[model samples]
Target: MSDALDQLKRHLAPIIRLQQIDGLLSWDQQTMMPPKATTARAEQMAALESLVHELFTSEKTAVLLAKCESALADAAPDSDEVRLVRVTRRDYDKETKIPATLVEELARHQALSHEVWVRARRENNFSLFAPALEKMFALTRQKAEYLGYRHHPYDALIDLYEPGMTYADVVALFDSLKPALIALVKNISEAERQFDDSCLQGDFPVEKQHAFTQEIVQALGYDLTRGRQDPAPHPFCSGFSRDDVRITTRFDPHLLVKALFASLHEAGHAMYDQGTPEAYEATPLAGGTSLGVHESQSRFWENMVGRSYAFCKWILPHLQKVFPDPFAHLNALELYQAINRVQPSFIRVEADEVTYNLHILLRFELETQLLEGTLSVMDLPDAWNAKMQEYLGITPPNDTLGCLQDIHWAGGLIGYFPTYTIGNLLSAQLREAMLHDIPNLETLIEQGEFSSILQWLRQHIHVYGRKFLPQELVILATGKPLSADPYLTYLQTKFKELYAL
Candidate 1:
């Protein structure tokens, strides 16, 4: 059994490296790839995907997995070997169900779709992206059907990013959060907007934005030797290993907060990647457990740390050095309050913490309708606008600010929006737990130290890798199961103080 399991490991190892290679190429595509290389990049990805999918789901793997099961029977269930075998087997079972051709097609189309999304978002023309979105959605639905779900097609997609998650589960969770969120938002609407964040609007240059962001991320414990920061059309964080994390952000010369906060957000993701166990490198267990769990780390560091009063205090001196014209007069409390101010917005990435969940809720509802055929794709703009007005009390001026803003729908990432909320909820709860365990967390942050919080996450959450599901991690980190109470309370407390509500 030992020898057989070793053989199984041997078979799986190179495929993992293939996945990393693919990830690196994708990082390049988003960060440094030139326009002319788009088509070739798509072909390369499709070929790699086809090979990896076929190799991973081969008939020989089924035979080896039997021995793996026997070997893992006596091993601790939480062991990395057990986790790798179990998760790989599950993936293999699902993959072998779909035709390799279908898998290849999805990969090819996903590559093509990213380019389309970039063009559509730039051109501000949804029609340029409509056909691709239609094709991608059709493929996603078919993939869901192939994977076979008990309730909704979107559940299959959700399960890919978050193990053991279902559409019904998210729907029930969101149903509970909606009323509280709506009420809190209503309360904010009545509060006076006393703070004018016009200080963030000045003669800020992109070069300064980049340099300042790099400095802030470095101070926040994002290792520059292993990771990199680059500018992209849309901001994102991607990683192949702790040593190779990459984050991207877009800069606007006129608006200062966009690039600064985006860097902090992506830096949160980088920090998580850097925190993973070094032994797990080049294996399935090396990286984030799932996207939702990953988002929690990013949002936790980005909002809870970067926007916290302590963080503002620590960074204010350096900000005065980098962009003295804008931040010289702004005090730590002022920057903290300005960045934390509650406001409604169309873009999810740019939305403040208080209303970011609302944006996700809207997408979650809209996507559910789209999947059920209750809403037509052609009418998505109107539906999106109606929801925008209904939720934020303002309608988008165009598809660019509305339907075309997010690349998720265009890339066929249905059922992903809700993860943003889940991440936030978990972040708030986890942060609370950390504070309980280490009372001087704020003092540490103020002193430019993250040892306590980072150590807490590493021990409680990051070290586990993919050994357990998000549900399991939540319970381990927070004493109770997942709830919105911590998140809602956090938001109310922070924003009430900031906005003087």
Candidate 2:
């Protein structure tokens, strides 16, 4: 069994490396790649993706997996060896069904689509990106067909990011959440806005924002020696290895909340990657378990901690030093209220915690329609605007703020939006569990000490990496199945006090 496991690991190593290389290419394209190099970069990414598919789906990998499974038949069901074999075999079976040509085509189309999206978003022209989007969707549909699903085509794609999650499960979850969310939004909208966020509206220099974000992330235990931060059109974190994680955040000169929370969000993701055990490096377990689980970390730090009163207290002194004019008269409690102000927003990334899930619900519905062929690429902007108005009582004037705000669709991430809402729910649940364990957590955050929080997460969540599925991890961490009660309760309690509702 040990020998077979070793052989399987050896075979999987190069595939992991190839994926890391692909991640680096994606990071470079999103951040530092020259505009003119889009074509070449797309070709390079396509070639690498094809190579990875070929390697992962090869006959040798199948043989090694079979050998390992047979050899480990008697091993404990939850042992690392058995878990690795199970995960690798599942991946190999899925990859083998899809043709490498289709994989390459999807990669190339996604790359070109992302570039078109960037330009279209900047120009506020969905027409300019429509053809690319159509192609990406067509390819995604084909890919889903090839992968096969029992219920819906979207199920196939959703499972790729979140294993064992089904379209039915998501729909059921959303159905349960919709009424509560609508009621909460209505209650907040009916109440007069209780906080003034005008304090956050000032000239915050990019360099200073970058430096201040760096300070906060470092304090949060994102090791600069192992990982680094950069600016991107959309904030994200990519890990080549546990030690080589990269995070990015975009700065808004007039809005302090944008970059500050984005930085913390990406840092949360990077810390999860950085905390993975070294023994799991270059293997299937080296990264996050799923997009939903990964988003839990980012949203956890971004909202539960970064937007909390304690966090504002801890960060207020630094903000005062960095932008004295803007923050001089603003105290910690005021800043917290400002950042947490419940207002409908066009950008999902910039939406406050109370209204954020509506943005995701809108996306999830639209994407489901797109995948189901009911929503055409040309009509997406109108559908998006209608949904925005329906959910948030405002309509975006253009596609840039309407349908082009997210990079997910451009990158062929069709079933990814629901994970943000899922993450939000999980974040609150985890916070409840954390508070139960550490009664003084808020005080610790107020003092700018995050080591205990980070360590708790490392022990409960990060150490396992992908060794456990998201459902299992959640149950283990929170002592219950994933539920929205904790999140809804948290939001209701916090906002009722804030708005005097």
Candidate 3:
């Protein structure tokens, strides 16, 4: 490497460490810090982010990048340094266009609003969180304007999580899936096979919930050596590095399926992180390529594997062991049907498969309107309730189950919701592709073996990391750019079996 390249590393190393410090602080804020620490934490994050920006955009750094880019282009594509330079260059170019004020405001709101959102969600009061959300929307509009766009403002936003993904594409995907999902829901709506989900309701106790879910996550092959699972109000996965992956979930005493499904889902994400290219650790290419790809992994495990009969058959005995009173008479078929039950629900996190994307679609629509200046923050609760009624056919009695329910906008993730469905779509596509390699996926899952899926993910997607755009990874893995066919097919097949249509 050239002297310039060495100097760049010397300057950038401290920035990378600062980023890690911010990450750890953010994780601790969510998992352990007191509520009073919100403002302090936000200031800390803003300061570190400012430092990163200054270092990244410095005159000397640009000189180093100019030098390194030339050398990196000539190096083997498989080399770690080449990939890091390429990935870092892309981030540098993109982030440099964004003003520091905008970035800091995003950080600041994410911290304070998160605390407000928690209380508002708990109290079912959208008004309490409305002002902060208003500030967030104003900042985000400035963001989309700064980012600029050719066809749609939302397209610029979409590029954040799923590069090359257009707002138009998601609309088309959601439009096509709507009829199929509606039909599936209608079919099951008339079915006589009603599951007594009441057994899953009532005071079951959180201690047992954690213990049972812990076993399920372990069986899913989460590496305790490289990762950990914790409890958070809204479950998520994050890390300082690939080897330090963390997953979080919340427990509800009255709900048996909530914590278990959450752990498996988050474990899927943890597996993806833990499986990321080891050579890329401490560099930019070390995690899933995008939120969409990350979501795909989680959805794959939660739906394709966790909700499948094969997995249920394997875990039914153990689930029964946890709460014998509620589960003793229940068989795998019953459990599978219950977990995958088609229901119109208020909360996105708790929504079943048939109606889940509708929840995301609702967010996409509302956020689109909000960003375009057509919807006001104060009016959001009404708009949210109306959409819930329109989409899911049930209105949340309060904001806690409606506008204030999700942690996304409160965390300044304005353009992130669509990826949840993108992940759902990509996960199904990846599952279809995997069946070609492991035809007996059901048998493998029944044996409590998940390495087959993880191995395929590492080979096809994880190893490349951010070296590939999200869409490029989709093409490499599924032989297509992006579509809703696989997701629709899976839902139709599984629900058709369950409802016997």
**TM-score on alpha carbons, each prediction:** 0.97, 0.99, 0.95
Backbone clashes in model 3, listed as residue pairs: none
Prediction 1 TM-score vs. true? 0.97
The residue-level lDDT of candidate 2 at 229 comes to: 92
- In terms of lDDT, model 1 sits at 0.84
Query: What lDDT would each prediction earn against the true structure?
Result: 0.84, 0.91, 0.82
lDDT of 2 at 188: 83
Compare the candidates by TM-score and give the number of the best one: 2
For residues 139-176, write the lDDT of model 2, one tens digit per residue. Answer: 99998999999989989999998889999999988887
lDDT score at residue 254, model 3, on the 0-100 scale: 76
lDDT of 1 at 465: 75
Q: How many Å off is the CA of 189 in candidate 2?
A: 1.7
Q: Number of backbone collisions per candidate, in order? A: 0, 0, 0
Q: Could you tell me the TM-score of candidate 3?
A: 0.95
lDDT of 3 by residue, 127-183 (tens): 889898999888888887888788778887888877777889878878888788777
Pick by lDDT: 1 or 3, better one:
1
Q: Across residues 1-501, which tens digit of lDDT does each residue of candidate 1 receive?
A: 568767987888898889888888887887788888888998898899899998988888998998889877899888778887887787788888788888888878887888888888898888888888878878877888999898788788888888888998888888888888788788877887556677777788899888888988887778999988889888888887678888999999988789888998898788888878887766666677778888898899888888899988998898888778888999998888777767787788888887888798889898888777788788888999999899888899989999998878765678788788888988899899998998888999999987777778889888877767778888988888889889889988887776677
Stretches off by above 4 angstroms in model 3 are 1-10, 74-82
